[model samples]
Target: MKRGVEEIVPGTPPKSEEEVIEARASFRKQYRFPPENNNLTAAQTRKVRLIYEIDITLSEQIDALSQLAKLNLAIRNILPPETWESVASIPDLSSQQVSLKVLDSLYAVRNNLSRSGELARRETRRTDRNLDLATRSYERAEKQRMDFEDRTGAEDSNSSIVTDRETAALASQAAEEKLALRRLQSRLAQAELALVDNKIERFQPFLADHRLRVIFSPEHVQEQIGAFSAKEADLEKSLLASQEQFDQLTPNAPVSTGLVAAEVTPGETVRQLAQSYGRDAAHARVSLNQSWINHLNIQRQFYGHRVDFYQNKIKRRQMSEITRELDLEIQRLESETDYLRNRMAQARQDAVRIGDQFAGTTGISPQLIQSLQDAAQEIVETLRMEALSTESTLSRLRNFNDELLNRTSGYTWHEIQAILGDRLPLAWNYQLFILNDRAFRVSTLFWVVFLVVIGFFFARYISRTAGSLLTSKAHLAPGVSAAYEKLVLYLLVVVICILIFNLFNFSLTSLTVVSGVLALAVGFGSQEVLKNFISGIILLIERPVHKGDLIEMDGRILKVESIGLRSTQVLDFDNSQKIVPNSLLLENVITNWTLSDNILRSTIPVGVAYGSPTRKTAEVLLEATRSTEGVLASPEPFALFSDFGDSALGFTIYFWTNTADRLKISSEARHRIAEALATENIAISFPQHDVHLDSLNPIRVELSRQS
Candidate 1:
């Protein structure tokens, strides 16, 4: 093949001065006021100036009249005089030929009129401001022209300067005239707007007079029902169409590599093919997103219309049978609306997943990926708007239903039951499917959360009440009461979990599979937690180191406050609470102060001088134990001469007390012993040592006295 050569093109030449001038003149001729012709003689310039002034004035008038005509037509179309007159003349809607549809039309007309009036007033104000500025400019220009004429009289020689002043004055005058015309147009629009409003005002009182009658009329109610039903059907059809389109739109398929290899493919050709494929794929995705957004919007409109239809049905609930039917419809609508909300959420998620999968593929540039993301963002915004619209419509319907329910007392228990069921589906009867082959709903999840929260508090209250009853009525030990309470709570939790699983319709086989997977995960990643959990179960069953037991661990005395599944809470002597893991408590050595009984023997060691009366000191120690509070009386406090030291005799006081305050008891015993020893004139010993000097020579003793 011969090599191909690139073609080169020559650039265009620049325009000549005369051509440039002609182009500029043509452009200026298109505008309202063409630029001044400097080449003209003084007479021609004066004639052209006069003709331009007259043309501007005529154009201004034409524009003003055209604007006023358009405004009048718009107001007339928005609210026809016949419709307004018919509404105004009819005092009783039931007696007149007007239907609810006609009233609704009038309502729309009033809204349009109000909006038009407001917009007209705003335009009038804007025109007034512009006219003020234009009037000032014209006055200034005219004054300057007059001053120039006064200084240089009619016989002045400088005709050019005088011409310039006259031209300035004419231009300013033209601007003033245009603004004056705009002001007139704005005034005429306001006048027309007020006429429509006055017509609407006449109907306003009639509307108020027949408001209740219009609302309760069976014919009008049926009309609303039919209209809403038709709207819903139309939206449903459109939604189905959009969904079909979205489903049919698939991403561009990849080119066959075998076919490409069989053909003689150039690198540039392959690149172009790849680029086209990527662009087609991206475009397909954007179209799919747009289609899906349209589908969601239509689906949302259907939901809103259905809700409105059901709410409108409530107005005709005069009979018991009809009221019951209306209630069922309301419940069905609520459930359907909830289902739609969840489906929309799932659809949004699916769209995102599709975009993510596309983004991960090769042969796609960053720009293509960014474009896909932007499309997805637009889809999100569309969905958000649809949701807001649905919410607003549904909120109004719900409020209206609630107000009707409150105002009427004809509703039976079935109606109340239906309303409550609609408001709160706590019975878990409503089934909303999220995933195919499995029925799940956002409302179900919400109910689960609500029930769990309420159940949690309820369980806590029941457990505490049971614990109190076991402690007070049955006279059970605190540890036993706590263990029973915890067992009750855990059982309740297990029951809640089972109920939740049942709500999901999970089979035993599925739960077993899930359990096996969780067990494997626990064995690998949660050994400590598993160990602690099992240890806690053992502790709860075995009742070791239970609540209200005073125990010493890690050289610190602590009181057991509560026992939990994975950890035990204990209060230290310093009044701070600490959490000790169940496994740690099981493995570490702990000293239980009151394991079998609340009473425990505590000893206090005291030393006295090689004394005159050791027996007296013993009696005093025993009396001290008797005097101190929280010291048990049945065990019989006693003192023993336990040991002898180099300078004093060691005495120990032994006593039994149920009180966990060992520090307070011991301190009190020591104080009593010292006071009694002092009162009996028995000396307490301090550390004393005797020193001996041994030397071969005679030892000399010297005593020094200070004056």
Candidate 2:
């Protein structure tokens, strides 16, 4: 309550001039650096742990040297001089220059580690200074916050003394505002009643004096009616123009309402917001209409009575003045009514727009909608809490005001002091209110929903772009590209989800509960999808087959088209695409002809007629293979005489091709070999049968008897 220049800021501890200087001197005490302290710091702890290990290593080397010494002494007599000299070199090996140098280095390191704990302490001085700065800044901010609370009753007050003062000030202010607002209302009421014509008992005396009375002349009455009609017409025109401009308040109104609760202008007090309510003209007009509608009716009756009195009493003196006042009052009331209607319409329209925004139909995001909803709920709860808190505060304030107003009362100032010491009752429910809740402020749910939406598109774009780049520029195999692309996409998704979970303010214990529930619900249904997903990752990493690589699995020769997250697409020899689940690929044995390299080693088996020269047949087969297109010449095609068949000699040609599609190359090679064999007069043999008929003449005589 008392404001003045003191030794310290408000809400800070008071200190004398001498005490302040002493405090400064204490802070400035010169640091006498301690003598070389050997106490080990934290960083050396790891090195110190190796102490026993280093001792064991040294002990092992010592034992090895001792054994060598015994061996040298025992063999010295039997050995040749050169051999004895070699034995003497054992000591030299132990004392070699390189060995001494390494030992000296280790010794130096040990000494340094032992003596340099002081240096470690010196290195931490900067950290201590930084901590000191942080502490001082924290104290300063705390003092500032306390000062703010003392002056404004903003921060939660603990000390009864500070709480009492702040509560007393707030109570007094709320009372003062309520009183002024009420007084203003009373004065406005009197002004409206006076402005009305019906409450004219005081004016009846003047009218009762026959001399002051005005006569009702027919010509003047007719002119008054015409003038009043013209005024009404002008006022109607003004009201229409005012209604058109009434929407000016619409833009600023929504902005103020839409702001998040914590973002109010700094240093705002409860009193300031209360004062603004009366400043709104539309609100004031609406209040006046609702509170004094009866007065308005009375005013209407007064206007009628005065006009009737003028007509009856034949009054002539001040008839025009009374009529003019009635005309102005009627016009003002009509304009206010029209303006209020227009303002209400604008308010309704703005409400609808805000509602649409909240419902996510106005292109405003749901997070923004949630933020707006939270802000509004916080405001409502805050207002409700304040209302509950003010009931007791207001009651105490009114009692105090009444006590102050008493003259020669038994309630002395000592008793008043005693009464002020007692604090108002607590608003117990305010503590339970959600206005200051951290859950609303954390915006966890909003960000989770938002990140998930963004992560999906981001993962998709990266996967697609990676696949295209690897296939076109990097020239990776189709399956490899597909594998890598999908791999990166899935990894990105997992990383984002993990980061989102880690960033959540709420404990993941709750998330675990939710996830457990979901897992239980989805366990059976999602098993296949889960299996395929894991298998796809395996397929990508292991790369049993790449896209465009010919693979034979389960007796089907299929070429891999692409690898996906759940399924791998392949093309049959008939050029039809087949989607095979990734699980199938991992479960079955797949023969990837070109997984490692593109060159496929093709083997073709051919047969030649029996009794044909084996050397000639082998030479013919080799020449045919060499003539085949798409076959590598550097490997030197070789023909293996595999077996001697019943009717022919079988030979197999082995060769390699650079062509990726081995099927095409194999077919072309077959065509080339056929032409080459025919040109060389080495006919390809087929299974044949020859019958010997040396004893068949007796069977023909038996067949003629049956005829």
Which candidate number maximizes lDDT? Answer: 1
How far residue 217's Cα lies from its native spot in candidate 1, in Å, is: 28
Report the lDDT of model 1 for residue 314: 35
Alpha-carbon runs more than 4 Å astray in model 1: 1-436, 700-707
lDDT of 1 by residue, 572-610 (tens): 888999999999888989888877888788998888888
lDDT of 2 by residue, 1-707 (tens): 11122211123322333543443344234211121226854333322333323333333333433443343333232332223232234332233122222222332332333334344344335444544554554455455545655665655455654444433433333333233333322322322222222212222232223212334445654675575566556645644554444434342332233433565541231222222321243333333333233333433344344446434431323344544554554455455545545655554554455555345344445554544444334333333333333332333222222222331234435445555564322221123312223343334445677998799789989998999999999998777887788788888898878777666644456567678978986796788988998898788898886777878888887888888879989998888899999998888787887778767688999888887777877787787777767778977779889998988889898988874656677888788878877887878899998997787457544435555
Q: Per-prediction RMSD in angstroms? A: 26.7, 45.1
**Candidate 1 TM-score, C-alpha based:** 0.39
lDDT per prediction?
A: 0.63, 0.53
Cα-based TM-score, every candidate: 0.39, 0.35
Please list all clashing residue pairs in model 1, or write none if there are none. Answer: none
Q: Count the backbone clashes (under 3 Å) in each candidate.
A: 0, 9
